[model samples]
Target: MTRSEQLFEEAAQYIPGGVNNPLRSFAGMGQPLRFIRRADESRVYDVDGHVYIDFVCSGGAALLGHNPPLVKKAVLEAVQNGLNYEACAEAELKLAKLIVQLVPSVQMVRMVSSVTEAVLSAVCAARSATGRKRLIRFAGCRHGGFDTAEGDPSGVSLLCGGGQDVLEAQYNDLSSVERLLEENKGQVAAVIIEPLAAHMGVIEPEPEFLQGLRRLCGQSGTILIFDETVTGFRLALGGAQEYYGVKPDMTIFGEILGAGLPAGALGGSRAIMEQLAPVGPVYQADACNGNPVAMAAGFAQLSSVLNQPLLYEKLAREGEALRAGLRELFPECTVGGVGSISSLLFTPGPVKHDRDAKRGDQGQFARYFSHMLQNGIFMMPSQFEPVFLSGAHTERDVEMFLEASAEFLA
Candidate 1:
């Protein structure tokens, strides 16, 4: 057996599912996970020393690609000082300031260790502020693994297991949300959504739909929270809020903010954010909230994106090229979404809801994913997850991917 196979066997003995995350098990592709040894700009090296062009991009965290020199240097410097102080650090303050500046709606921010924590904290704060129990989340718009946000809330009978009172609405369908709000009536604390549903294969909100949501939240006194974990730095330096021109009352950020380190954040208007402990009643705290190394790496990454605005333009161009290539390679495939965040649905056009996405050819997608991996182009194993492209991906890489995809389609 190979070294990675041996490692997987040992890992299975200790770790449940032999993977840190459920999706990393490669169950969607019907293969064992490729244990990666190292990564550099736009590429990952497996334990067997095989290199592959990375489209996962650490699940959309490595926007500037893996181990960029500046982030690496910042992390190194932070390590020399300390890993975690267990107390507030200047890096946290700096990151907060940068986030506020970039996202005008975020007047105050609180740091956390992961997007899951950030989502939970944000919802808690929303509940505290609004004094409500219900939350409305759109179908397929995954915020995180929060109990309240898990499963199909629309009573579709495809539940993934979690808590209760999470009412579901259809994407781009304002009436679905309206019905939930009407049903809950003054009992809904918040409506959390991913403006671009990357988890459900990259379906973006129509302008009318987004505006309607904002209006509905205002009418109902419910907090509007945007989970920009994947689309934050990757879509634009300002994130999906900027791209869509629709701001949320609170925003949950992750990955790109951490510069490949473990970090997440909840930010919003000062009035709402101050509701957390040390200021108000809703208590939320973490021992390693602001790990110095993570903060340093995050600061370096955000600063790089801020300084080089053209990086976003380049990413857009690459995304367009990729989309075009995919269309040429698979004429029957449905492709859409904005900026570098895009997806190819193995179905007919007009995939606006989870039901639409459910009808996709999963068997064909499995073949496509396996073929792409075998050809040294790595994408997310699940058809539900959107493929990510980084600034590190070159035209040559795009061409290579297209070539491989053409073969797979053929």
Candidate 2:
């Protein structure tokens, strides 16, 4: 057996599913997961020393690519000083300031350990500020693991564990949201959604749909939140909210915001954000919310994006090339989404909602995923997830990927 196989065997004995995250497992691909030793730029080296061009980009966290020199230097400097003080740091303040400047609607920002915590804190803050108990979330738009945003099997509530009042609305369907607001009138605290629904195969909200949502929230006094955890720096430095020109009452961010470090943030107007504890009464705290190392890395990363705006332009051009290549190679498949985030649905026609995405051919996707992996291209094993492009991906990288994809499709 290979070293990776042996490692997986040993890992299975200790770690549940032999991996920390579900996507890391090879269940979807019907093969053993190849353990990666390290990643640099656009490539990852597996345990067997085979290298693959990574399209997953650490699940959209490696915007500037794996361990960019600047981020590494910042992290090293932070570590030399100290890893974590569990106390406030200047890096946190700097990152928060940068975020506020980039996202104008965010007057104040609160740091957290993960996107899940940020979402929970935002939900609590909305509840406290509005004095309401219900929430409305779009179907298949994952806001971390928060129960309030989890989709329900029954197609009614947000999730089974949460109360039935957490209604589920279909993406791009303004009427669904309007109906939910009408049904739960005066009791809905927030309307939370992934501005670009990455979890459900990258469903972008229609202009009218997003405008209607903002107007409905305004009319009903519901707190509108854009969960930009995946789309924050990856889509644009200012996030999908800025890209779509649809501002929300609050924004939740993670992943790329910390330059691959474990960090999250909640940002909104000061009046709404002040509801959190120590300022008001919502009550949310974290021991490592602003870890010094993570904060430093985040600041460095955000500074790079702010200073070098051309990086996004490069990413956009590369993403367009990659998307075009995929369309040419697989004309039978459905390709959707925008910017650096895109997905290939093994079905025909445009997929505008989760229900449409559910019709994708899982078996075909599994085959494609396996072929890509075997041919030195790494992507998420699940059809529901989207692929990410990085500034590090070159024209050569795009060509090699297309060649590999062509062979796989054949």
Candidate 3:
């Protein structure tokens, strides 16, 4: 048996399902999960002495790709100094300053531990700022740690609770959002959405949907929150708000902001963001918030990735080429996403929302996944997940992927 198999066997005895994250297990994906030794650039090396081009890119956090020189150096130096300070650090200030300079909507930002905390904090900030209780989230939008559901690969949760304060609406349907706003007029605190819906196979927003939402929020005095967990740095240096030309009152960021580390942030115009204590009443704190290592790493990565000339252009061009190739090769399958993020849905065309994404043939996808895994391609494994591209992924890597996919089709 392979060393990875042996490791999985040993781990199953202790670690639940032999994996830390549910997607790490091969339960539904139709093959044994390959154990990775290390990742570099655009490739991951498994314990079985195999190499696969890593398109997952740490859930799209490694836009600069895994362990880039600057990030590595920053992390190493920060580790040498110390781990956590539980207080302010220079690195935090640097990263926050850089983010504010880059993201126009986020005039002020607060550090947090994970995207889940960022979402919870953002919701709380919105409620506090507007003095309302209800939150409206879009179906199929992801909210990090709160993004949990079983079986249905095309998970379509609005990423909110069923309690009195939470309400849901369908994605890309501004009419639905309008209906909710009207029905709950003066009662809704915020309307949160994944500006790009990166969770459901990188579903781009429908034309004018965001503009309408912004207008409605402005009219209702409800805060508009954009869950930029996956889109923040990956989509564009300024994120989806800049990409789509719509500014949100608050932006929720994920680990991507920490350069693939366990850190996140919530931000908005200074007036709204100051609602969080010790500036205001809404409370949010964590021991690992603004961890020095993560902060240093994020500072280094973002300073480089967001400022590098034409890096985003390269990613966008390459992503389009790859998707175009997939479209030609897998004519029956649907290709979705924008900029550097792509998704191959084993379903029909125009996959806009969760309902459309759910039509994917998981059985066919399982067989396809098995074929791709055996042939040195490590995709996100689920139809709902986005296929992330990074600066490290060479043209040859894209060619190799398209060739392998063509072989599978043949």
Candidate 4:
């Protein structure tokens, strides 16, 4: 057996399912999980000394690609100063300023450690500001594995917690949202969505869908929350709000903004943001809140994004090349997503919503995933996740991926 296989076997003795996250288990793929040794640029090396072109990109964190010198230098320097002072640091203001400057709707910001905390805090602030109870989240948009009142809720079931009324709507369906608004009326505190549902294998919002949500939220006095954890700093320097030209009242950012570190943030207009923490009534706190090292890495990464010209264009071009290549190679399958993110669904065509995504051939996709891995291409184990490209991925990487994909489909 391989070292990865052995390690997973041993880890299962201690860690549940032999992995920290459920998705990492590689369960039902008919193969053991690969334990990564190291990654550089667009490639990851497994413990068994096998190298593969990486499309996961540390769950969409390494936008500049794995271990960029700029972010690494900043992180090392920050560590030299200290890790977490447990008190306010200058880096906090610097990072916050950069976020506020980029995202126009985010006039104020609060840093947190994970997307889970950021989403929970944002929802709390929304509830406090609106004096309402219910939050409406779309199907297939996962904020995180939130511990709901009932324990380990999945999908729309996450809404079942704290006696807080939660509602679910369909993606790309404006009438569904409007119907919920009519039914719930003034009780809806916020409407939270992914903008681009990367969690649902990269479902982009229809222009009218987002614009309609904004209008609906405005009319209903509901706070619109954009869970940009996957799209933030990835779609653009200003994120999906700038890319799509539809802003959310509150935005939750994660991972990519931290330049491959563990980090997340909640930001919004001052009127709504003032409702969180010591500034207002809603309470949220973490011991490592605003850790200096994380802020430093974030500041460096965002600075590069803001200063670098044509970065987004390069990423988008590469992403398009990948999608186009897949469509050409596998005409039988469906391919979609936005800039720097794409997915291949084992379906004939037209995968619009969660229900549509469920119609895909899971068995075919599992076979495809195994075939790609054998060809030295590392893709998401599950069909529901996106293949993330980074600025570090070159045209050569795209070409190699296309060649491997061609071999798989052949």
Question: What's each prediction's clash count?
Answer: 0, 0, 0, 0
Angstrom error of the Cα, residue 7, model 3: value is 1.7
User: At residue 382, what lDDT does model 3 achieve?
Assistant: 83
lDDT (Cα, tens digit) per residue for candidate 3, span 1-410: 88988999999999999988876668887788899999999999998889999999998899899989999999999999889989889999999999999899989999998887888888888888888889887767767653434433222232434456677789989889889989998999998889988766778888999999999999999999998888897778889999999999999888887789898999999999999999899888899988999999999998887568899899999999999999998888889878889989899878878889888999988888888888999986787788889989988999988988888888
Q: Residue by residue across 1-410, what tens digits does model 4's lDDT show?
A: 99999999999999999999887768877666899999998899999999999999989988888878888899999999978888999998999999999899999999998888888888889989999989888877787665455442333345334444877789999999999999988999999999998765678887688999999999999999998988898898888999999989999999776787788899999999999879899888998888889889989988887777898999999999999998998888778888898998887767788888878888888787888788788988988889989888999999988998788767
What is the Å distance of residue 164 in model 2 from its true position? 2.0
| lDDT per residue as tens, model 2, 266-375 | 99999999998899898888889888888899888888877886888888887788889989988887777687888888887678898888998999988888888888
Candidate 4 Cα deviation (angstroms), residue 207 = 3.2
Please give the lDDT score at residue 363 for candidate 3. Answer: 90
Which stretches of candidate 3 lie above 4 Å from their native place?
A: 147-161
The lDDT values for all models are 0.83, 0.84, 0.86, 0.86
> Total clashes, candidate 2?
0
The runs of at least 3 residues in candidate 1 whose Cα sits more than 4 Å from the true structure, single-residue gaps closed, are: 146-164
Predicted candidate 1, C-alpha RMSD: 2.6
Please give the RMSD to the true structure for each candidate, in Å: 2.6, 2.2, 2.0, 1.8
Clash pairs for candidate 2: none
Lowest-scoring 10 consecutive residues by lDDT in candidate 4? 151-160
lDDT of 3: 0.86
Error of 4 at 251 (Å): 0.2
